[model samples]
Target: MIQVAAAIIEDEQGRILIARRKPGKSQAGMWEFPGGKIEQGELADDCLRRELMEEMEIEIDPYAFFGVNDHHYGATHIRLIAYRARYVSGTITLTDHDEYRWITARELTAFTFAPADVKFVEMLHSSKPRLNE
Candidate 1:
């Protein structure tokens, strides 16, 4: 199974950060969490940190474990390991994604996300999660 690490990035206002997949990419145009696949021998936390930096040019410290989801899309299968990460510092830069936005939980349902992310979204709904003040 493919190992992927994702972040539920929450800002001070309790808004979550989501990225839009670029054209021609898998799940193109879908809004999903900022993360990428884990490389061999890399820790999930490290992979999340690296992917955030690489994909969004932002740094994050995975402060808490959130949840995990296993999904299969027939052709490809992935084990998505998610975490609640604290945004540290850095200007937002788009590398892999076409666009990004900070949206509230109620607004999340408006956008389409990868199937693997649905569980995390539900978790956010159940917990009404917020960042540290």
Candidate 2:
């Protein structure tokens, strides 16, 4: 199993960040929350912070677990830990993705998302963050 971490990064205006997968890559052109595979022995939040910096050149305050998703595709199954994060600072750079957008919840369905991310986006649109934890 491959472990990964994704951020549901929200801006002050309540818009969520989404990125387009670069062409010729696996799941090319699909929109996804920025993140990458977790390296061995690293905690999930550490992975999220590293991936955001590497992929988008941004810093994040990792807070609140959003949800987890498990999905199988072809030969490998992926386990994704999703988190709610607030963007701290960075210049937007596309190291892995082709494009980025700040979109409202209602706009999520407009993009073609990776199967795992699609579920999370749907949940984001349908529910409020539970704060009693």
Candidate 3:
């Protein structure tokens, strides 16, 4: 199983960040929490921090283990681990995605996310989750 890490990045205003996959990517045009696959000997948190820096050119302080989802598309199996993260600093520059946005949780249902992210979206129907506030 492929281990992937995702960040549900929330800003001070409670807006969560989402990224749209570029055309050449696997799930082209689909929106998702910005992150990448975990590498050997890397912790999920470290992977998230590294991925956010690499993919969005931003830094984050990830916290509160959110949830996990195991999914299969055709033959590809992935275990997506998510966490609530605070946007620390940096300008938004998407490297792996075509577009990105900081949206409220309620607006999440409007955008089509990658299948593995659906559960997380559904559970986040309200404003910032009841995480450590």
Candidate 4:
């Protein structure tokens, strides 16, 4: 299974950041918590930090372990590790995503998320994420 890292990044208002998969990328147009694959021998936290920096050019303070999900898309198996993070700084940039949004947990269901990220959205619904508040 391939390991991946994902972050539930919250801005000062407690709105979580979600990104749309860019055109030509896997799962293009689907929304997801911001993050990327964990490189070999890389720590999960480090991978998350690197992904946020590389993909969106934003800095975050990841503070707690969120959860994990195992998913399969055809032949690819993914183990997604997630963390709760607070937005630290930087303008929201999109290199890997076509768009980005900061929304409340209640608003998550409105967007169609990638299969691997569906569980995270469900979890947020079961209980709101009070990241900034």
TM-score of each: 0.92, 0.93, 0.94, 0.95
lDDT of 3 by residue, 35-95 (tens): 9999999999999999999988899999889999999988989999999999999998987
Please, what are the lDDT tens digits per residue for candidate 2 over residues 17-128? Answer: 9999998889998999989999999988899999999888899887999899999998899999999999899988997899999988877889899998988989987876
Clashes of each: 0, 0, 0, 0
Of the pair 2 and 4, which is ahead by TM-score?
4
Clashing pairs in 1: none
Best by lDDT: 3
Q: What is the C-alpha RMSD of each candidate to the true structure, in Å?
A: 2.1, 3.4, 2.6, 1.8
lDDT of 1 by residue, 1-133 (tens): 8999999998878788999999989889988888999999999899999999888889998888888899999978899999888888899999888999988877787888988998988877676545441
- Give the per-residue lDDT digits (tens) of candidate 4, residues 66-116: 999999999999999999999999998889998999899988999999999
Q: Output the worst ten-in-a-row residue range by lDDT, candidate 3.
A: 124-133
Poorly placed runs, candidate 1 (over 4 Å): 129-133
Model 4: residues with Cα > 4 Å off, grouped in runs: 128-133
Candidate no. 4 TM-score: 0.95
Model 4 residue 132 lDDT score: 50
Worst 10 residues of 4 by lDDT: 124-133
